[model samples]
Target: MKFKNRRAMLWHFLKGNKRFFVLSILFSGLVSLLDLINPKIIGFTVDSVIGTEETALSPYLESLILQIGGLPYLKQHIFSIALVVLFVAFLAALCRFLFRLFNSMAAEKLIKRMRDLLYEHIIYLPFSWHNQNQTGDIIQRCTSDVEVIKNFFAEHLTNLLRVVLLIVLAVYFMSGIHVGLTVLSAAFIPVIVGYSFLFHHRIGESFRKVDIMEGQLSAVAQENLTGVRVVRAFGREAYEKDRFEEMNQKYMNTWIHLMKLLSAFWASGDLIGGLQVMLVVAVGAVLTIRGAITTGEYIAFVSYNAMLTWPVRMLGRVISEMSKAGISIDRIAYILNSPVEEDPEEPVNAPLDQDICFDHVSFSYGGESPEVLKDISFTIKAGSTVGILGGTGSGKSTLMYLLDRLYNIEPDEGKITIGGVDIAQMDRRYLREHIGMVLQEPYLFSGTVADNIAITQESTEMAEVRAAAKIAALDEAIGKFGKGYETYVGERGVTLSGGQKQRVAIAQMLIRKPEIMIFDDSLSAVDAETDAKIRKALGERTDQATVILIAHRITTLMKADNIIVLDHGRIAESGTHEELLSRNGFYRRIYDLQSPEEA
Candidate 1:
């Protein structure tokens, strides 16, 4: 089934480049037919010029011309026939060359098409799927592994097609001259193909491991590069080097296995082909001597045998490459075939009026483990702020994710509703459209300040985007930039300070103007002043929106209408700022520790 999935993925990807894909194969097949012609032309020329007949080409020309009663320069015409044969051979080769060139270009176009399709799909995958998978693993799949597959397409795909055509045409030509020799030539096909397939399976396993190793190596390198500062701060350069070398060595071993399979594939093909040649020659020479076939005919047979060498041998090489590339194909298909997180039921687009409710909501991923969120009940009135404070592993963000229905598999236990309509019953897209999120470490795209701010909801007008920026308090900062809103940010907005990234993220969310805004400790990077200003602006900007702010800073939630302090996945205390402080529970202690002035 996975194999079928892989084929389906390839078809889907190639559907965009169907014309180029089809044309490339046809052209490669045509070129391979020409490949058969050169040897025949050479053999025919040899027989005509040096055969046991007198007057190389004149006799036939003279006979033909004499029959027409207009013989013109018979000797010169004979010489011209030889020139014509040479020219025909040259022209055939020229056509083959051009066909191969076009074929390669077409394959490249197909690679681009596949790459774009895969990359586009990746960006759209749900965060739940991406959260479980590593960034380096995904990156390796898109780059090195995909390149191996692309190279296989641009080179070996046609070569495989060419081999099939070459053998078919070669066999047809040889059989026309001598049926027995052609049969003898093809007798090796089964043995060679069988042996090559054995190596194919072996190499496929090797390459799959190679793919895994590549991901590991990429993970190490990517982590080290991204966290070089962390590495140096801890002062463990030698340990990191040893770690990298170990992964590199694992990759080297996988490479060795792949190389061995390639070598064995070629050797077995060549050996079987050589043995087949011996049998053909021994029988053909005896036939020649007995006047059953001419010396020239035997020469042509040798030419056919010579032509079989590359195709049969190349058959093995192509098989090996396909095995490796096939592993890559499956690796990529694993991603493509994975079921993305989908909404549980038909979505309701009703506007919110009352409190959000969690009726015994419980969830777990994959198997029977302790529930991540069990009997998680909640309520927050419309146009109010709700704060969730919990220990590190207490499902704080998980609760927020549930509101967006980011998981395909819904909670096994209960119902969560907004405006009396169950969230599970609401369309995923519509729910997300009405919700905005800013994570603890806000991610920014590689673009201008305006682009990152307006990413989720695109409006072409710069003035409109700046309006959101001004609300998030990023307007003054952008104006000071050399290019203003047009100023380009480095990758991941690495050039921007942490607080700046958070503000831009908030600006992005603000532009969306969702009915429910979720902040998963998003303001941790900002100074107290900026945090207070943005919170104030946010409260005003969304006077009718429900705001859920998750934070460790007690000051961040002191003014909230409701605060739910989570202790071991249950609410320890839930009330307004004054009520929770009076309770002297988790919220009270945290607040005291954070804001001694207020405490």
Candidate 2:
């Protein structure tokens, strides 16, 4: 649940693949060792076989050569030395292949694990977190930031280890020829590393800026696509285009600036590396002429020096790029660190038949914001219908949200209970499973009509889907479609009319047949006759369920057993229709406006 650092977090996801990762590093070291042997073979051939001089093989190497017929045999068949070099090259190539294969496999597995964890965490996170964060920014972090971390582990980290090992091994072999030249070659490494450290430290801030700008640009584009209809309705094509272009230009400029910084660092590294090589070559020529070292030794040392040059130079760039990964890791860590919604330690089960009570409950959206609901007390008895009438911002929806446990209420503020048990102590999933709600704005996935209707059920039964649709007054409209229940709804149900989408959502909740049903102004889009028919059908079908209806229409609630009127976060009036009409209160006024002929 808690990771000590970014590497710890990565390792957690890579637990099963750690063996492959270790093998890859070991193979990389093997490849470097095989490569280092080639120059030594070339030097030995030059000294003993090609030139008129005694062989200078180490004791172990000399014993091995004797087994293959000694110096005389090598001199007679010179191609044998070529064959030796080819054999070493072949092993080196094989090791390199295995190294890459293992690293790729580990990297891909890490990526899949990371993506799965991020998505699962996002869905389980508290609703308030989603309301606070931008969709595009979160998506970018889940995708782009995750990729950066993967590359860091699979490529950058591996390469860092490989380069360091190669440098250490090369220096060890070069020291066998002359310690002075090896020291000279290694002297520039610290300078390159130190300079690179400082440069990357400064460049990290720039990379963060570029990453944020990219997320912002992506958000603008995403918002535009999602609200394409609104944009066209307002005739704001040119406005949206200009806005996007401005963000695009800003994002481009930030990346260009980052590239400029990278170019300067690379150019500086190249200059230092070039000088180091020049010093090595100049000193080796002096040592050779003065008989301090042999021509063969001098040639092998320079070859080793050449091998180390690029890796040392690349070390600086790798360190710099690694800093970018740190920023990405921190970004990903933010999501992983956020607290998930927690269930009570001792959870209570929701009763199948019970009264739902809101006992002096009040709520706010937190952080010094004004309260949205205040001192709200109401009760819906078992197997009864209750109506809620309120204007916009009257907290009708917020009240239902509390009952569903979408948001929690503090002990000091109030409590809601079901069947004499506090709802807060109930398991959230268990509580919501028994309570069905149809929201004011319905969202449907891209699927067939039957698929949308039966989404809440574990298995789709065509009969039940059609039956629910009939109760919601949606079956006839669905039948008219070319494919009927099989027709695709498109993204967010863009293919369906507003009335049809609401009806489909109603059908979805109806299929569940929950103990408590809440309709938060779910019938506003349908015509009066269709609304009445659906209400009539719901009344006949859901007689045993506790139904709480929130509607602005007086006609919708006039026939309910009881109705409560809300105004400005408080209950303004509550009574049956005839009782409120006798009192001439807020409910009576609304009834008058809705039915002036009867009034």
The candidate that achieves the highest lDDT relative to the unseen native structure: 2
TM-score to native of every candidate shown: 0.81, 0.93
Which residue pairs come into collision in candidate 2?
none
Task: Indicate the TM-score of model 2.
Answer: 0.93
- Report clash pairs, candidate 1: 347-426, 347-427, 348-426
List candidate 2 segments past 4 Å from native: 3-8, 246-261, 323-326, 492-494, 595-599
> Worst lDDT window (10 residues) for model 2?
590-599
Report every candidate's CA lDDT: 0.76, 0.88
Q: lDDT tens string, model 2, 1-599? A: 55679888877778788888898899998998999998888888888888766756679988998999988889999999999999999999999999999999989988999999889889999877887888867988999889988888888889999999999999998888889888888888888777877887788789779878877888799999999999999999999999999999989988998999899988978898789989999999999889787777788888989898777766776887887787888888899888888999989896856988889999998977799999999888888889999999999999998999888898899999989899999998998899999988999888888888998787978999999999999999988998889888967443888889999999999999999999999988888889899999998883499999999987877788899999989999988988888998888777777864531
Count: clashes, candidate 2 = 0
Give Cα distance to truth, residue 533, candidate 1, Å. Answer: 2.9
Q: CA shift at 126, candidate 1, in angstroms?
A: 3.7
